[model samples]
Target: MVTALRGVSERAEAWLDVERERIGLWLPVALGAGIAAWFALPAMIQWIGLLFLLAAGALVGVLAGWQRRLGRIAAVGSAVMAAGLLLIWARASWVAAPVLAQPAVTAFSAEVEAVEPQPAREQVRLIVRPLRRPDLPPRVRLTLRGDGDGIAPGAFVGLRARLMPPPTASLPGGYDFAQRAWFDRIGAVGTVLGDVVRSPGARRGSQPLRARLSAHIHAQVAGSPGGIAAALVTGDRGAISPEDDEAMRRAGLAHLLSISGLHVTAVIGFAMLVAMRLFALSRRLALAGYVLPIAAAAGALAGAGYTWLAGAEVPTLRSLIAALLVLVAFLMGREALTLRLVAAGALIVLLWRPESLAGPSFQLSFAAVTAIVALHESPMMRRFLARRDEALPLRWGRALAGLLITGLVVELALAPIALFHFHKAGLYGALANVVAIPLTTFVIMPMEAAGLLFDSVGLGTPFWWVADHALRLLIALAHAVADTPGAVATMPSFPRWGFALTVGGGLWILIWRTRWRWAGAVPLAIGIAALLAQPRPDLLITGDGRNIAAAVPGGGYALLRNRAGDFVRDTMSEAAGIDAPLGALADLDHVECNADFCRWRQGAEEGVTRAGQGIARGEQDAAARVILASRGRDRIEGAEMAAACAAADVVISDRWLPRECAGRWLTIDRDSLAQSGGLAIYFGERPRVVAALRAGDEHPWRQPDQLSGNDEAVPTDALAP
Candidate 1:
């Protein structure tokens, strides 16, 4: 043990010496670690308090370094880590908007701040300042029942709403809507009770520029193609139908729809080329000064403008930073793409919004770019590119080869991240990118930009018509690819620790400059093995406890719900790596579900027998394993309730808890669901409870005080005294 410790200490010392000249390379990584620490922490820290702690830590670190003769770089690294902590804490505190304190609100008046397009209806963002109760959250996101035609941004409108707090994850390890809502500063979400009445003084201007552009696009053209155009132009995907969106995602063409690195680079490149040519044509400019700077400036403006038009989302923002760095390189007469610039951009972005570190967009985008740049800088790639003296056709062939290589590298780099977050990857992503990328960069984007310009002069229809045609072709290709056999592959939920391991390995590979970097593959392989070994949950219960899904024998899940439960069933199926639809899986041969109950017959299926019988509902003692009840409670009398309780080993309520279930056997009700977020039951020798929301999840966003207690008994008649 002592020998090992000494060896580790020596290695660490050598590593520090090596990193001294490249300490800046580790800043973004340290910042990312700090952001991760914030997420793992049990409590949220105030910005002021975090700043004080940071100051104290910096002072201590510096004093210790001076007293102990520690290297200045090492000491500064400690201070930088402290700074990172302060950045994330400050950003979180700054964005911690008020949340509604009420458990349920039947009615409230709000001033409509913005109107957004949705596939089903018009979603409205309202600023609600209650005259009687000023303590409640001021901003709320309300989804109306229909298309609010007259409603626009900045419209002061009054509407009755039935509001509830933003929902948490519906099932264990599922989507965390509450976390997203917290960052978005949306306190409550609900539907309008009726038509929104706009005040006579209703106006506009508070709406985001991107939202307004999206509205205009929809007004100009209506349909899926128009939705595609709007999404490509303004990053507003609200109008796209679920079918189209899913098809695009499965085909791996979804990135083209969003303004990303490809779009920004292509647009800037085209603009610079145009500016250069125009300047070259002018004799006065040719005689005056260097035209490269002027053309590069124009390209920068174009990139920034596109970023604003696309709402400056994470991907677009990262690409814009890259474009600016390229311009800076041009001005300095140096190569544009470099590792140092990538690090600088990453540091700037992390400092700007530390919360972005947790998002898939940021992770996947940065990973792909970093890998692509590293590949371009490799010795072998440089040797390959040196063959520019070859024939024109050979050079063209090389370019095509490079494009294919680029696609493969990016897809490979993003594979683990996609699996960790989405659990699905497109098998034909590289081929799809080869065809789709050039089409988007050269044709679709330019056409749309031209259309936007021409529309201002009343000559936009032709350009838009051409753009729509291209979109149709792209959609067709996506549908074709997505429909292909095994076009997309799904995997079981990858463990978070495995993801962490993979990320660490990737960073080591990218950040190191030594042959020892190959050692990263060790952790990468181990992480994949761990991910493959992770077990899928046997059963999932929705947060309301109204819907339940049990894994089927081969794959997929059989759901038992009073209503359609599409979201829960599909989510569970995906996590289980089930490729089929929920409805198709609902009628698995071994499963029998009726209006009152669902039962898995023993010995009817191979895997189900070992997995245990999943029983839900029915009055007889035959369904003793599990009983789920939601409806007919208003119909059941006192005696019926007692009999129902006596018949089952466990009883679950979708709406409210019954007093009879307080300590008898085990019960999951709305109260427990609210407190726990969601439930995953693993039927090993005996059933075990696995909560979605851990003890550490009780942050300000959750507003734990508003959630019901786990052991609390709720009366069947909630309004009863």
Candidate 2:
């Protein structure tokens, strides 16, 4: 036993050492110290201390590197730098924490910055430049309410709104949006107070340069032939429509819609080619060496495109910096595709805004770049491509292969986080990218550029025709792809550990160039295994206070109460994976609304007896059993009825009552049934269930343990008597 214990200790120590080497143990320690300082020190002192610490640490790092023998010194400096970063982050959090904690209330004076209007619903986000509350955070984003022409992006308007945090819902075993929003720095979210009142200030500054440019481009390409033209140039989705979006996602062409690494690279590459060709014809121009610089400037402009001035969003800026770095390297006569450029871009972004490290855009962009660069340098890919000549067919094949390889690597890298954030995977994304990326990059971008030049030169007719045709083609492609079956899969949610494992493994595979680095797949496999091991919920109920739906697997369901709305029924149907005819439940001998007992009889062999007018029950004698009720019921009066249904494993009610009943009791009330703005519960024989109930349980179906603890009559309001 002693020998085994020693071996375990050694292994643990070695593992810790490895992690320390990779992440520098001092970073976490420093972060912890910074967190501590935020609570302990004054705000001004904290900021001063953090600034000094950063300067001192950076000096130490420089000195240590110069000495070459000061390993410990470098590590200590790194830790200090890490701690300083933490302090800065904590300080920001401190300033914002109070405003975030306050309940969202009506703020009449707010400025609308952006509007995303859908066919069914429109979202207008505003920058709440607080004039009355000067000490409050300067910029608070609020969503306004109203329909029609008054609201536009970049408009300052007077609107009232009671902002709340984003709403959360549990979809079986799935990701939680509320938690994701917290990490994303969204302090509060809520609906509009009333009809948005547009003051005279609304018209002023409504069309900023970027907004005007986006609008103009959108309008110019509105009648374009394909979806590709609009997506390639301006990142405009207004002309694409929902059907087109769905199609692109289905066919794996969805990445083209988002301005990412592929689009940037294509723009840069095209500019470089054009510049070199222009210079090749003139020796004097070549001698002056204006080609690289011109190309670099053009690439930067292309990256900036029409979406540059959206308040310096980290992801877009990061991509632009990376593209600029590549251009600079080319101008300096160095290999532009090195990982060092990637690292430089990362470091620069991290220094500017550390919070972006946690965002999806940063993760996805870097992951794709790292994968493509690594694969390009791989012996296998190189040897395989070398065998094919540089013909058009071969080039197209190479592009397709590159797209697939990069897409697969990025998907694997981002899958865990995507699932954690959205709870859905774009299964067809691999195929979509191969077809969509090439079409957008090679065909659409150049055409859009031509159209813009022509429009500028007063030859607008031809350019407009080309743009229209391109958009239509792109839309058609997206539609065709999306219409196919099984385009995406809803994944069960996995915790943070799964994300860490997946990302760590993916990074190892994509970034590490060593031969034996394939072992990274171990963690990747473990993460998937962990996700697959997650437990499934046995029963689900969905409603909006008007209707209540109870569903089981294999399309079996019992409705306790049917009201005016079918929203609950639709939600339940999706949750239960029911695709059969909706009216089939009526033919299954289920009970209809009656005067006395709400009941159902299954065939001739089975009989279900429910108590009270609103109480409902369904039982499968040889299999599972259940009891359901309407809005108000505590305990049934008839002893014979209780005894007759004594074998039931679970009893469910729309509301709770003060009564001692057999088996486990579930309730649907404000504290019991979630569908009615109440808590829901699942009671069983397990001790864990009892402990869970005691843990300040917030489900709508379970009564608060505090209420049950008192011997005095439960409040009439608390129980349905």
Candidate 3:
């Protein structure tokens, strides 16, 4: 026992030494822990704990920075964790402050904080802060219904508008729009009641510099190729068409629209190289001081300027920070692309917005960089690089092989995350990237950058035209790739625990500098197994309880209504990993649909139903296993329909069921749907039901009662009374 204890102690000491040597890794780990802690907290108590953590973190930071070797690891880790907790909590609390009985419709004088024009919708997104209400959320996003041409960023305007808080997730295991809105400081969404006439009382706020820059670029290239040019240069995607965006996403080229590591690196690298060369040409200044410092400074400034011009969104900001870290490392005469530099950039981002840790943007960005660093340091890559000075043919072969390997590694690193979040992987992403990346990097981005700079002086037309043509080719390539057979492979949604395990395993594999890192494969494999075993919900109902889709036994969705809305159909298809066409009902084995009802059955099962003409008062309807209510037909006034629903095992309706009919059957109605957001029902002897917005969502952000003011109650599908 003594020998074993000594051995364990020695191993632990050695591990601790390794960690100390790689001290920077602790920051990212702590940041992750802080985010985890924040999410683990109950909604009600989250803010309170965050406040306490803030004060504690500040104290720890002060103490830690005071001495170099006074329990340095423990102090640094504690400080980082505290700082992470504080940042997220403070931001959340400030953005999501409680407001009771905010008017849904009101006339208020407002200053347009920012204007994001959507050419596709012939509308404009106005970020407005109310002039009068101190109690209102700090900002509201208002979509002006029509062409509000004269309106620009910083223009104050007054108009009557309907405002409501951002919506919660429409379904269980769906994106949390409310959480996203909270971080964006968007208290509510509104629509203009009428024309957005500029109010004389409107005061100009700080101008949206990025929006102005993008608008200027768009004006120069207004008709033909301005959208992609503006997007590439200014990170403004407002002009890109929905079709193009979808094509890019499906082809795994959507990252081109966003300002990311590639863009930042290119912009800063070009600036640095130019600045260094210019400085070197002047021998006096070059000899006076280190050219590296001057060049690095120039690059950092360029990155910062570009980030500011790109709205400094999370992804852009992350890219800028990463660029700065690499530049600063170069200035310090250290290798720029080290793990320490990666950790520093990640730590800065987490400190700024710890919530980013959960977002796909952060995960993919950091994972790709980390994987690249690991690959660079791997024995295989080192061996290849050792022969870089060989013959020209061999060198070219090495370059091609390196590119292929890098692309593969990045795809592999991001695949699990993409699958978990989107439930679809781009089957031809690497091929698409290989074809598109060079054109984007070498041709399109450079021209766009030149266009943006020259457009102000009327010299950018040729550059803009060149960029546009390149973009056209890129788009054509993307569409071609996306349309290829098996271009995207949809998979079932992975469970949260499984995703968490995958993340943990991946981090272990990347961060642990030991042979034991292979142990991460064990958990990774388990996570994959867990995902495979997870089952899709049998039936899903929309938030308004107006639409539903039931899963077929073999794995596909059948519309409960023949003409399901886009939201219902898309959500169901995505959840079930079935890329069915819109309003597709053919997937079900034995399906029948009419204006009155839609029904389907599989083998021995008593299948699902909708309250329709063919379904009403039928003997099959009366004994139906599950009955879905008709859309826009909430009132069940007739005795026959009520009687049939009452006899059914589960009744889902959008309208009000007769009072007498409600007691016998399990009914999900308008009131419940309104409160819960959406419903998921599983079919079996004992059906399981889940609500999108549960009792816990009674928190300030999800006041269900407040959300549905004066809305009429209707019935929805219910498994139990």
Candidate 4:
């Protein structure tokens, strides 16, 4: 029994050791990345302070390293880094307060630096270089009408027009454009003015060698291969139709289009292979190794435009770094890849730009690498690989299986994050990836390379055919998968706890060699369950002429009111969990009133007599149990209505009250409200509240005919009390 216990104890100790090492390695990387993101902070002071902290920490670490206690020194260093990162984050949030506090502006002037057309929506994401201001940054995004002028990618123009924050409804669980822009150093946002004035500074100067190369490749495939070449080589999809984009997404080939890890790996692998073959005649391993690195550098330069266009996102960077490391290792005659390469790459990126740790690309990229490494080292995968030394057919079969397995594993690993951040899962992602990966690698990439080569020779016809064929194939694949039923599964957004649980579980599954991997399922299940258990709101009110919404519940009815089309559309769509028609509420029960008294009645429900002026006297006793008014309502009338519905709930309009109102009033402006009373919520802001009302909550107030003498409307004075 003692011997058996000792064996178990040893295993546990080993596991703990691995966990600690993983944390030590990853934590520093996360901290570093987080720090780098400080540049995106709106305030300068915070950035300066963070810079100071980081500098101080590094100095301390170096000083401490002079002593023999290396581990202690490292710990201190990590703590300093973490503290600096936290301070930076805090400062950024402090600066962001004012931005969020201010109401969104509609009209503004901005300089357009780049325009990416989204043909499906007839829109374009205008990357604007904002004019310097005392308070804000110098960049922003303006998603405006896409009138295809065959606008070049880097054209600069002055734009002036309305700009509003993104509607909450349009993107449920996807990227927050506002937050993303903020992180990308974007300031104020707005659309084009009348017509974009082509700025004198708009023209790009004489292009660099890489830029010229990209332009040449683009020109060759522009008319023929179009979207496919754009995606494969340049990572530019502004020219791609929405249909094609959606199809690619559905087919799981979306990664290929993005010029992510797969593309980088392919470039490196191809370069290495070509180098090896060319140097085979020389019979010199060193020469072959050197050639591969040079080839990789060339490939990297060739794909520079794509990398930059994709924002040189963390995952792409990781792949590039890994590839470079592999070449270096080969040049040194190292037979095996090391985790240190990945660690070093991560450390370098983190040191340069720490804020990347919070990004999905960073997480996904690192997760994929970690998964690959862990799996490759696992007994199961090694055993299988060792036995599979077959010819082309067998190799192909193994490769296919590996692809499928990797896709499934990565998808599963990223499931929680996707559900939390995107609020949806691509059900057909694995299947889509299977088709898209090879097509992109074997077909699209080669065509792009050939096109570039042909363009260099001033013969564009062959390249055009390749581009055309690739685009057609890509578009068809994306459309077929995207259109399939249940291709996307929508879920409620999960909280941080759920995300933590899910991520932890996923890591366990990937890393744990023992049966403890099954334990990971617990957190994953919890995350999914939490998302599924989210409650629906009772009432939803769209902001009047603004991109805001509110959910209200009182009496027997839930009221959803909004004047803005975008707000209304978003609220209804989110609340209903469907693509609600734009004008669906036009004929539904609605209350129309100016700044004064608003009347509420169901458009569909009959016998609801429309009361006029006398109704203001509170004689009939049947106005909504709550009288919701907008801002700037005449005080005398508002007081009267409040008094009339004193026994009932009087929810003042958010607009009517000061920017900061007392918590009791069923606040109705842009903010959200929770439903409590026995009210079948008709509102659509908070889903959970609506779900509660659906579970049967009778309204507090009933008509005089239905009520007894003991129950009469409460006085308005009682509302405040």
**Model 4: residues with Cα > 4 Å off, grouped in runs:** 1-25, 28-137, 140-159, 163-175, 198-225, 279-311, 333-343, 387-395, 512-521, 538-583, 586-665, 670-721
Give candidates' CA RMSD values in order. 6.5, 10.5, 7.7, 13.3
- Cα lDDT of model 2 by residue, 1-721, tens digit: 9999768756645544444433332343244334334322434555567657756666776765533324344546546655645644553454332224334455445455455432222444455443344323344556554343535665555545566443444343322344334434444565666665555523544545544555556656553333345455545454455546656654656666676666667766776677678766887767887766776776677566633643345555666777888878877888888666666776666556554454566666666676677677678877766656678988878867866876786666555665554555566676666666666666667777776777777776676676566556766766666666776554434645776677667666665555435777999888878776643233444322223344333435444554423545544444433422233222344443333223332221232432233433333333333443334343446463454234434444434323443434333333443433312223223311111112332221122111111112212122110
Single out the weakest 10-residue window by summed lDDT for candidate 2. Answer: 702-711
Over 4 Å off in model 2, which ranges?
1-107, 113-124, 130-156, 160-163, 168-188, 191-195, 200-203, 223-231, 236-240, 272-283, 305-314, 387-414, 540-551, 555-721
lDDT tens readout by residue for model 4, 1-721: 9999768766865665555544444444445434543423434565556567766765666675434234334555556465546654664454331122122333323344565655445676776644433233345566667653544455544444444432222323334344444445454455554554544544632323433344455556554246557556655566566556656654555566666668887776776567656765565645555555566565556445446655576767777777667666766788445555666777766655455665676776676676767777677877766755479888888878877887777666655655565555577777777877777788777766666666667775775677567667766767777788877665544655666666666666765556666888898789667767754333333323122222322212222343445534544444433322333222235544555534343221322343443333343333233434443435544445544334324354434444333323344433332222122233223212221111122211100011011112222222210
Q: Itemize residue pairs with steric clashes in candidate 1.
A: none
Q: Model 3, range 164-247, lDDT digits (tens) per residue? A: 777666777666777777667677787888655465444545446676777787776663256767777788787777678778
Displacement of the residue 558 alpha carbon in candidate 2, Å: 9.5
Kindly provide the TM-score of model 1 when superposed on the true structure, using C-alpha atoms: 0.85
Per-residue lDDT over 1-721 for candidate 1, one digit per residue giving the tens place of the 0 to 100 score: 9999768756866775665545577778877876776665655544345546656766775775543323454456556766777677677667787665555544434455556667533454444433223434556777775566656665555556666777877766566777777777777777677666554443533657787788777766677777888887787787777778889988888887777888889889988999999998888887786678889999999899989888789999999998899899878889988777888889989988788888888998899889988888777887877766778999988888887887888888888887777778777878888888878877887888888888899998888888888888888889999999998777776777788788888877877766767789888878988877866666667777767766655665666652555566567666666677654323667555445434443223543343445542232223224443443334344354665565545566676655653324567777777678677766544557778787645466765224211122222222110
After the best TM-score superposition of candidate 4, give how far the Cα of residue 309 lies from its true spot, in angstroms. 6.4
